[model samples]
Target: MTAKPLIGITTYLTRARWGAWDLKAALLPASYPAQVQRAGGLAVMLPPDEPGAAEAVVSRLDGLVLGGGEDLDPALYGQAPHARAGAPVPERDRWETALLSAALERGVPVLGICRGMQVMNVQAGGTLCQHVPDLVGHDGHNPAPGTFTDHAVEPVPGTLTGKLLPDAFGVATHHHQSVDRLGEGLVASAYAEDGTVEALERPGGGFVLGVQWHPEAREDLRLTEALVRAAVEGPF
Candidate 1:
């Protein structure tokens, strides 16, 4: 029997309160692993580690998943921290970057969700709009803080995201930030009604896609399945 592909997902390293203990823990929403498992991949949580440790970890995994989280520090993209920017997660930022760099170097399939997508952009020398409402002039993309809002996104044909969601579909979105400049070698594959970049992909035989929404939060598992399929197929 063929082995199920191993999917490594980065988890948030933050203070937590659980079962009579409060300490910094590496935790991820259960939805992430649930999505991966439902899509037929073995899910593994990767905690923040020393920068040099990522390459060895990537060498063993079939694919990588960067899950959603807080707003990123603008300094990484050569800007001062916006007043709305979440507290700096320097460790996570460095750790995820190392993981992404290793995965890209080894041609491993990657699926970045929400903040994960932003990390991908910055890692590739791109910038981000500090606040979505400031640019779009509305709160449609993210109507409430800490809650997802439904919005339709039109996917461009002939791209990774487009192939999966060819038609405009509603996705769960809860972000205040959006991609600004296009990252080198990255293509914007989908956009919201307000022209907010909804999805991005690296056009190549390998699977490297990022969506500005949270797929795991929704019942739709197309994106997760695609990542598993890519892992099974290996690099092209």
Candidate 2:
């Protein structure tokens, strides 16, 4: 029997306590693994590590899934902290950014989710708003923290996400920040009613797409299936 495609899902290494001198550790959402497996790919947890760690993991995996998590350390892009910068996890940022670069170079199919989506943007020379409400001059996309709310996103017709998801869909959101400045190679493919960049992709890359929503958290597996299919069958 043929082995399932080895898909690497990036993780966030975080310290449980939000204090100085506390030991940091790795933490990945369980939904990611379940979703990937449900979509027919073998999911492997790839923890954030040194510069070379990404390349090592990419070499073994046919696909990459950048998982969701905390706000990134703004210093990665030479920026000062915003009021909503929260706790800076330099180690995690360094690890995932390096891994993302490596995965891109290796031409691995990539699906970035939430913080993963933001990392993809930063890796391609982009910046974030830190907090959408503060920058957008409003509060709707992210209403309450740690809760799921639906937001409207208009998808670009004929794009991967468009073909996979509904033409105009309500996606679950729980992010404080949103994509402010776009990156080098990505094209903003979808947007919220308030004009937040809800989805992005690189046509030049094999299958590089990022969405600022939690698709795995939902039971409907179409999104995950489409991603896995794209990786296994190549972007069409």
Candidate 2: 10-residue stretch with minimal lDDT: 14-23
lDDT by residue (1-236, candidate 2, tens digit) is: 75778788988776655457567666676888999999999999887677766677788888888888888888877789987678987777888888788878888788889899999999898989888887677767668877778888899887777777757878888888878889998888888888899999887677889999888878878777877776778765
For candidate 1, what is the TM-score? 0.97
Reference-based lDDT, each prediction: 0.92, 0.83
Question: What is candidate 2's CA lDDT for residue 226?
Answer: 72
For 70-177, candidate 1 gives per-residue lDDT tens digits of: 777888999998877789898899989999999999999999999999999999999999988899999887787778889899999998788888899999999999
What ranges in model 1 sit over 4 Å off?
A: none
Q: What residue pairs are clashing in model 1?
A: none
